[model samples]
Target: MADTWTAIDFETANQDRGSACAVGLVRVVDGRPVERHSTLIRPPDPVRHFSHHNVAVHGITAADVAHAPAWDAVWRRILDFADGGALVAHNAPFDMGVVRRACAHTGLGHPAIDYACTLALSRRTWRALADHRLPTVCAHIGHRVTRHHRADADAEAAARIMIAAMSEHGTTSLAELSRAAGLRLGRLDAVTAPTPVAAPSPVGPAADRFDHWRRAAETPMPQACPDADPSGPLFGRTVCLSGDLAAMDKPEAWRRVAEAGGHPARNVTRTTDVLVVGSHAGVGKTAKHRRAETYRERGQRIDIITEAELLSRLGMTGA
Candidate 1:
């Protein structure tokens, strides 16, 4: 809801957050988008392989960005385009992750830009929608995202959605809008390295719990419950996890997966059927997630879902 801010989106060449292939930015001034910019980028070295799934999503193949400028070459232009305004993005974490990881990979300094997620804001604004995906939210607010995956179109759609949310709530500023929505403005520096599960101290009850959790996460694939409902969403699926879940520890999540008749694996594999992506808000995808994308690119049927979706599938919507 800032009078002047930027809505941004990035399309990746593959699963690596650093593998940015395209970027789009829309600058909104005084509640209206007054400028737009987009560019194709050659992803950083060693992570530039264009996966088939990613290409199909945005239709940007390696050939398309074969001659494009790399992240280091275009990052300054992107920063200048934003003009010191906070960024807004549909899934701000992913887009921001792209920026952070790309910077780290290219040895560029982080741009210290704060951002807000339209996806999160839309959830607070329109709670009745069955799903709060970009396209669905856009449609609800009458902002038709004709080109869903294209970076430019998605950026524009996110901008419009933010505008609509601000108007709907009668909020005149980003802070006000965020307060109304019960969320905080996210910044890139807010993201931290993954917190490793603690090692047991062998002396206290907390240590015992930690030990149990550590084993659960490190356990080999467990047998599914025979009494589990066969028609359940996760039934018969091979599920793997990535990142840290805010709802529950990995052990609890894995136990629930097994109880729901899903085979909970310790890692992503060709045979894995679903990758449940968890949240450490502002954190990026994990190696398992990247591997899952690779498998999907190779035509494997794997669903990379959010922890909320996983809970929904496990019939634990609010648990």
Candidate 2:
């Protein structure tokens, strides 16, 4: 946890994690941030179903990227900016997933990233804060941030918060502060840029099946948040994930949910807190999760995240 690194934020098209359409980078060296970069990346998939909610956030649209470079085109720049540094973000695994998808698409070697999450660091450093959300945290620290969902502004704000935290905590060097922030690089590759993954035939049974589901229904809200307050939707509860978070690593992201006074349960049952669905989720488990259905039908509290949207939710936007 003792290294200077770059922080990144990705905004995706709609709700797909694999659909990173824009990225931002902030490089911090010697505890002072330098080198901010951002670019719109065209996902291989067209950004259909663009949401008003999302458009309000990042301001990206099909029109904006009518002729932009694909994710394949701009990934090298992202990798280069991240060179020789641990990748820092609010949610480490989410950004890593987007990076993984970009790698998978290009057939490139997945780059190793040392990680430091402001999300995790917030819990460690700011025990008095009400919420660790970017804007909330920034407001608590008295930093004026305008855009709530853009990638660059958020990344810069995160970088500033990191700098302030280090100063407040009195960590003289990047290494010292990094360790305190839980910066960890496990078996990370030393290379700056990786060879791209070869193109997959964007056509296949899995792709077709997944597409069919998207084309069929209005793409149902995946699953509900899955926690019900006697009064409202998980207003003041805790939800946890154990075993596996499936894809996008639920435990890592949901750590914030738990820290926020939402209790996360290790086991699923009648008394279980919430069920976070992962890629490894099974229909049998769904069948067993009758609680989810019951709550959904009654308009209680429920939440589910697809692997990709989970990653997207974790993506930090300056917007």
TM, every model: 0.64, 0.63
What would the per-residue lDDT of candidate 1 be over residues 189-235, giving only the tens digit for each residue?
A: 64334322222122222336556456665655658865454445677
| Per-residue lDDT of candidate 2, residues 1-319 (tens digit) | 4446788888766444456777889998878887899877777553333445456667898788767788766777876887867777665545665676566555556555666666656655776765466776788778888976678887887787777778877885545765765543323444445554333222222345444334323322122222211122233543434323322223334443432335545444445445555533344545425566576667655564444333333333221
Candidate 2 runs further than 4 Å off: 1-3, 46-53, 181-268, 275-319
Clashes of 2: 33
- Per-prediction tally of clashes: 0, 33
Cα RMSD for predicted model 2: 9.4
Q: Top lDDT: which candidate number? A: 1
The worst-scoring run of ten residues by lDDT in candidate 2 lies at: 221-230
